[model samples]
Target: MFGPFRLTSPLSGGLLWKIPWRMSRPQKARQRARLRHVDKVVSIVDQALAKKGTTTAAVERWKAEMPVEQEMLPRDKYTIFDRKEKKYRKGIHKLPKWTRVSQRLNPPGY
Candidate 1:
């Protein structure tokens, strides 16, 4: 465990891997699909609530505050604000759990 392999890893103060600065086209496509799936789930829930004569405030607030995937600009869809990054932005894919977490919004004028 003290040879070249471990020596070159995080335990030895070296990065084990690096995330790319940009997402590949296929990755972007998958990201889009995930966004669409989330949108679909929200819409379905809204419809269900409508039929039940009740709507949750959280869902209503989400619909009001968040843009649907189709409505987002390319910049918003692909990147997020990062105060430490050059130009104050970074690729969303670089975030941990990018596929599982919702990160569709950023502060205005960033």
Candidate 2:
């Protein structure tokens, strides 16, 4: 004979079941913040793209014209990730160390 297994225990009640159903408060808050930031960035890019004919060349030109100090400018300004290897052909220019440091520390979305 198997021992009696009661479904309702004093310590394990509705609260125990509810715990899994509830989202972690901190995780939810972080997700909301990330969504907001992504939306803002998308809006800014969209606004910039909307001004002219919205062509690839126009976007590339606009990106190239941006200041190097700006976060968005480095990739385009330095052309480090360029597939054509035009700018960094001689390997004189390199990404700053701080970029890697920040990337490791902050990460994408917490």
The CA lDDT at 95 in model 1 is: 80
lDDT of 2: 0.39
What is the per-residue lDDT of model 1 for residues 12-105, given as tens digits with 9 covering 90 to 100?
Answer: 6756667788988998899899999999999999999999999999899989999999999888888999999999999998888889999889
Worst 10 residues of 1 by lDDT: 3-12
lDDT, model 1, position 35: 91
Model 2 error, position 96 (Å): 30
Alpha carbon lDDT of each predicted model = 0.89, 0.39
Residue 104 error for model 1, in Å? 0.8
Off by over 4 Å in 1: 2-7, 14-17
Best by TM-score: 1
State the lDDT of candidate 2 residue by residue for 50-72, as single tens digits: 78648466445544643223343
Root mean square deviation (Cα) for candidate 1: 2.8
